[model samples]
Target: MTVSRTRRAWIAGLMLALAGGLTPARADEPVTVFAAASLKNALDEASAAWTQETAKTTRISYAGSNALAKQIEAGAPADLFVSADLAWMDYAEKNGTIRSETRVNLLRNAIVLVAPKGSTQKVALEPGVDLAKALAGGRLAMGNVEAVPAGKYGKAALEKLGAWDGVRTQVAQAENVRAALLLVARGEAPLGIVYATDAASEPGVEVVATFPEGSHPPIVYPAALTKESRNADAAAFLTYLRSPAARPFFERQGFGVIGTEKRS
Candidate 1:
């Protein structure tokens, strides 16, 4: 009787262990996402949705697209990377750091000139207005072209529009587009160049003019599976981001949802 009871207890313990092992371990796994700083609000919403839908959690790190791209090149343990421009994505793809087939252009945005609401510096937007004359009121604000994708686009547009040479000296550079927007919003700078989405993000900033389409190369956002991702859930979330449900969300946040019709 004693032997039989001991054997039964062992069997019950084994069954419990087997049940625990059969349960999904994704419950504790973290999906790490590296994305552009401008995508903070939109990606946060998407991350919440992914977690709720899959019972898995995501932790995101946001920064300038160039900076994040360099980090990935140096072997950052990121499961996913979302870049504000395709340059970084292309770099990673060519270097075998990201799954090239997983690359997708997820969104688009445009550069714009912004000023603080009710600013004494009257920024005029008439056709053929001289950019140097317009930016002469106070210091200009812009993102650092070395690290920021928006800044790179803005600089390219200024260069293409023949505005960079005159206004380059007046510019005060920020680390990212949102930072540039903040400077203009605080009235610390008379003019700033940033993404239309970044201008829209700040309540106190107003768009003065948009960089003409084709003034610079298209601003495309690309996302890809990173080399360090361990969880299939991260891959799954990337799939969700490409779905119809995410399209409306990106559009409402000022992204021109790419891969969707109507170019909205």
Candidate 2:
């Protein structure tokens, strides 16, 4: 007997819920997550574990946090958002796109200078260091300094170290941190500034020097439920992201989990 389309959809949803170990929601829709591109590896692993353990599935979209935030403001149907920095999260909060009560600062990261895996380049990321001289005529790659968080942080650090002015003309800005990392890994750029976790995730690159913490604002990843979310499983999955079960995946990818700080 041929099942009706509606009935077939229900059955499929039920099977998915059972496989994920989660109770069926009002609708069988998967929780949709918008996250930073830098989180691709670790978050994918964490979501996979959550699906395996709970039988609930998540649909994640990874892009630059600035782009994701803009999409959310434009009414994208995201159940959860994980930003690479606090500023975008704050932007979402101010725009009433995310649930203030569900917001939390979930992770911390560090910025570093990186070179292709076998390159022998090193420079102290301190005031008065001649970053342009160290570049040896190669451009420094980073995220878009005006919008992307990684680029903003890299620019801030350089400014603090008095290097921004000299190297501004030599910088190659990518759309996001991952793109910048790829540029370095592909040898398109001799050096790149990116999060330490990003460098760890790419085998073709190596950290040349870590930016001093005081050189820039702290790198924090903030996560929250979107006000537009309709899926009941979203909150549970968000909690799972911070659980011990998910910690290993994040830590393995070089992300440091921060204690949850609820907004409201």
Candidate 3:
């Protein structure tokens, strides 16, 4: 028999209560969100604005989309999930970890080549650009290309530009895009591939060039409520994220707000 939404929520709460031998949290408790690391600055500001406006508290955890999706799969008590790409959000939906009806494309970003501040590395991201030679024997910092959304997008852009093969052996993979950005910011790596917003947030790094949108899969950020979310305020927070008030914060950080529209 098909269960109703109310029944399913009750069952989920019961299961969690039974598992922990404790009562479910009150409806007004803080909303917890698992978000992509690249969204730190804007999201934090937006969330703070929400709190200031409504007096509702939020707890946001930032990490790689792959890591956040896996955490949701493992039953982390997160009310919302914001991913850097559609793939991991699709994975969460396929795994039954997110509410399919609540999912929406939220924001967009572009990948860029970044170098430490004061470095005179001028790069044109055209086909067959000698990215390896620009590295000067230094490594290119990127998130784990196998999983992290930023890394996957960076790799795709590099491959499309015919530069991946030349520098594939010189990549220094990090746990997340922010970590890779740090590698460049700290001068541990001579160059890095990160979102344009990331390069803007860190004064220590300067953007060399932005990858063509056609060079890689569109960098779309999708947000959704987790299947296990029971906080009464969680849905409101998700809605607030798409509201007009939140648009400025994201735009100020170089993100394109997609509103309720889905990317084609």
lDDT of each: 0.80, 0.92, 0.95
Steric clashes per prediction: 0, 5, 0
Q: Each candidate: RMSD to true structure?
A: 5.8, 5.9, 6.3
Top candidate (lDDT): 3
Query: For candidate 2, lDDT tens digit of each residue in 7-47?
Result: 99989988987897755556557899999999999999999
Please provide TM-scores, in order, for all candidate models, with all chains considered together.
0.84, 0.89, 0.91
For residues 1-264, what per-residue lDDT tens digits would candidate 3 score against the true structure?
999999999999889877975556685699999999999999999999999999999999999999999999998999999999999999999999999999999999999999999999999999989998999999999999999999999999999999999999999999999999999999999999999999999999999999999999999999999988878688999999999999999999999999979555
In model 3, the clashing pairs are none
Minimum summed lDDT over a 10-residue window in model 2 is located at: 20-29
Choose the strongest candidate by TM-score: 3
Model 1, residue 250: what's the lDDT? 76
Q: Per-residue lDDT for 29-148 in model 1, tens only?
A: 888899998888788887787778777888899988888888988988788999998888888888888987677888888888988887655544433447778766577798896668
On the 0 to 100 scale, the lDDT of residue 84 in model 3 is 98
- Using lDDT as the yardstick, the better of models 1 and 2 is 2
| Cα shift from native, residue 39, model 3 (Å) | 0.5
Model 1 / residue 48 / CA error / Å? 1.5
